[model samples]
Each structure stands twice: as C-alpha cells, then as structure tokens.
Target: MIVCHCNSISDRDILSAVEWMRAADPQTIITPGKVYHALGKRPECGGCLSLFIGTMEKSDSLGVPAVLQNLRPRRGRFAGK
Candidate 1:
C-alpha cells in the first residue's frame, strides 16, 4: 500500500528500510526522517506524516534501542533550580 504518495513510498518500502536500519545499527534511533533518508527520498507535502509514522511504528523490528530506553530525563533533577 502507498504510504507517501509524493515520495512514492510504500508500506513494504518502509518496513524494509526499518529492518535494514535496525540491522545496520541496533543502537540507532528510528525516525521518519531517517527512514526517508534510508529510502533515498524526502517528504514533500507533509500530508503523509501521520500515516508514515504509523507504518513505521507497526514494523516488528522497530523499537527504541536498548541503550536509549532508560535515558529519559528524570523530572526532579531540574525541578529544584
């Protein structure tokens, strides 16, 4: 199915890109922009942003890298300033 009409990006294309990226660098963060870059295309109208993201999130290989999963900023550290 076509996810981004402007870029001619398909669901499979996105999935393949995601898998390739994950394999290439397990610690890399997967973003829509990165996926677009991996596919050798860029977003045009921005209409497909939501759908593009949804497709990426649905991929089995898509996950926050383990190294980054626990890196969220703690709220209290900066609250006492």
Candidate 2:
C-alpha cells in the first residue's frame, strides 16, 4: 500500500525503516522525517502525512523506548518556587 505518493513510499518501506531505526538505536525517537531520511526520500506535498503516520503507527517498533519515556518533569514539581 502506498503511503506517500510524492516519495513513492510504501507501507512496507515505512515499517522496514521503523524496524531498522529501532534496531539501530533503541532510544531514538521515530518520526516521519526520520523515516523519510532512512528511506532516502523527503515529503513533497505534505498530503500524505496522516497516512504516513498511520502506517508508521502500525509498526510495533515505533513505540518510544521504555528507558527514554517519562523524562519530562511532572506538574507541580516547581510550584510556588
């Protein structure tokens, strides 16, 4: 299934890129731009962003690594400082 017509990217391409990125760096955050870069392509019209993201979301390797998650300080950490 074609996800980005401008880049000629297929669902498989996105999935493969995601898997490869995850394997290369488990802590790296995966995004459309990163996927495009991995595939050696770039977005043109920006029309396929939603679908591109949808395809990426389907990959199990797309999730942020557990170690990298929840790094932001929670609310009220500096209240009334």
Model 1: residue 3 alpha-carbon error in angstroms: 0.6
Tell me the tens digit of each residue's lDDT in model 2 across 8-31: 899999999999999999999999
Query: How much is 50 displaced in model 1, in angstroms?
Result: 0.2
What's the lDDT for candidate 2?
Answer: 0.91
* RMSD over all Cα atoms, model 2: 3.7
Once superposed on the true structure, which residue ranges of model 2 sit more than 4 Å away at CA? 76-81
Runs with alpha carbons beyond 4 Å of true place in candidate 1: 76-81
Clashing pairs in 1: none
TM-score of each: 0.86, 0.87
User: What TM-score, to 2 decimals, does candidate 2 have?
Assistant: 0.87
RMSD of each: 3.7, 3.7
Which structure among the candidates has the greatest TM-score? 2
